[model samples]
Target: MEQLLDYINQHSSSGISEKDFETVKSYFTHKKLRKKQYFLQEGDICRHFGFILKGSMRQYTVDDKGAEHVIQLAIENWWVGDRESYTMSTPSVYNIEAWEDTELLMISRQDVLELFQRCPAFIETVKMMDDRNNIANQRRITSSISASADKRYTDFINCYPNLLERFPQHIIASYLGITKDTLSRIKRQLLQKE
Candidate 1:
């Protein structure tokens, strides 16, 4: 909770005073998920957004052919939930699953709205997060459509070096929209070049 408050304060345009920050912190509740647990599944209505405090989670969609497409990988201090579903009150297409034993600070949509109404700093933090998310999504889209496999892999490393150690190769490949074999070949080719 302190981590989340600190994160909000850091990202916010203004600092939250200790008493106010405590009030802001009160809006969240703690939750945990074991490895392989589902925070959300396809066709479910997403009710709460969570801030990861510890461990990792993967957000993905399963195709009709039973293939999973990794969309987002979230770890500590990151936020998770199907935003569209949570905001619009619709069923989600993605599954948010715990990749490891995970702890989170969960907040309801109503609480978020209340925060936005009550705290200018919280609004700023949300805006900053939205801007960052947009930039990342745009880069991912451009790389997915135009970049070579090697280039994509390199970009993935540059963007999320920490993830390479945390997630499996196959999972990373899925996130990069590449096959496991292609990722292997790229890694091998790069290794040989080095």
Candidate 2:
């Protein structure tokens, strides 16, 4: 959990004293999940907010036609959760699943609210993370509506270069809102140009 503390300290403003950091840390519990394990399932309550200590996870939803649409990917040092369900105590419409053997530090909704109240610096930290997520989501939505498939794939590759090697082609295609065959053609076209 030393890395977790380091991440907080680095991201947080000077308003967070050591005591505040300790208090925030105390509320979290550690857990591990195997690859293919689920952190949250559709229709389940998302009880916890999680920080990935190691490995990766994917948040996605399945359509009526049974196609999975990737919502987001969380990697090491990133946070993952269903904010609406976790905050409101409702069922989640999405599933969060481990993409690899994963370690996480998780805090319950109650504890998260308590941290926000108790640690002033945590407010900024949380807001910063949330802002980044929101911006990324907005960009994805805009791209989906306005960009060509090849352009969207390029943007995805540029934004998450490491995922090319880390995730399977189908998952990457799903994330870019493209088919696997299209992704392959895009990759090949780019390679030919290079």
Candidate 3:
């Protein structure tokens, strides 16, 4: 809980009061996931939004052809969930899986609603986060549509150097909307250029 508070303090300048933190903490349940475990599966409602205390997670969707499409990755100090399903209480389209042994502080939609009603500052922080996430998604979509595979791979590597090291190339390829074979070819080209 203290660690969560510290993380909030670092990421948000709005300042969560100790009392508010305690109130927020009351709403959260700590959870652990073994590597490869799922936090949420497609066809199930995503009841909680999780804040990662340790380790990494991936959010992905399986296509009709049974291919998994990577949507996002969250590491320590990040948040992961199917926001639409969590907020609307609908079945999720994505699967949220642990990429490593993970610890999360999770809050339900009801708790989040209560927090928003009780804490204007926290609400503001949440709004900021949402805005940033939307912008990022938009940027990724634009890049995918406008950029070449090599350029996209370069942009991804530049943007998330840590993910390049931590995630498998195939998953990264999926996230970039490219095939694994294409990613391998690009990687080889990049290496030759280097």
Highest-TM-score candidate: 1
Where does candidate 3 stray beyond 4 Å? Answer: none
Q: Residue 99: error of model 1 in Å?
A: 0.2
Q: What is the per-residue lDDT of model 2 for residues 23-67, given as tens digits with 9 covering 90 to 100?
A: 888999999999999999999999999999999999999999999
Off by over 4 Å in 1: none
Global fold similarity of model 1 (TM-score): 0.98
Steric clash pairs (candidate 2): none
Candidate that beats the other on TM-score, 1 or 2, i.e. the better one: 1
**RMSD of every prediction:** 0.8, 1.2, 1.5
List residue ranges in candidate 2 displaced over 4 A: none
Q: Give the higher-TM-score candidate: 2 or 3.
A: 2
lDDT of 3 at 13: 73
The digit string of per-residue lDDT tens for model 1 on 1-194 reads 77987898899767777876777888999999999999999999999999999999999999999999999999998999999999999999999999999999998999999988888888888889889999999999999999998999999898899899889999999999999999999999999999
Candidate 3 lDDT score at position 102: 97
Scored by Cα lDDT, where does model 3 land?
Answer: 0.89
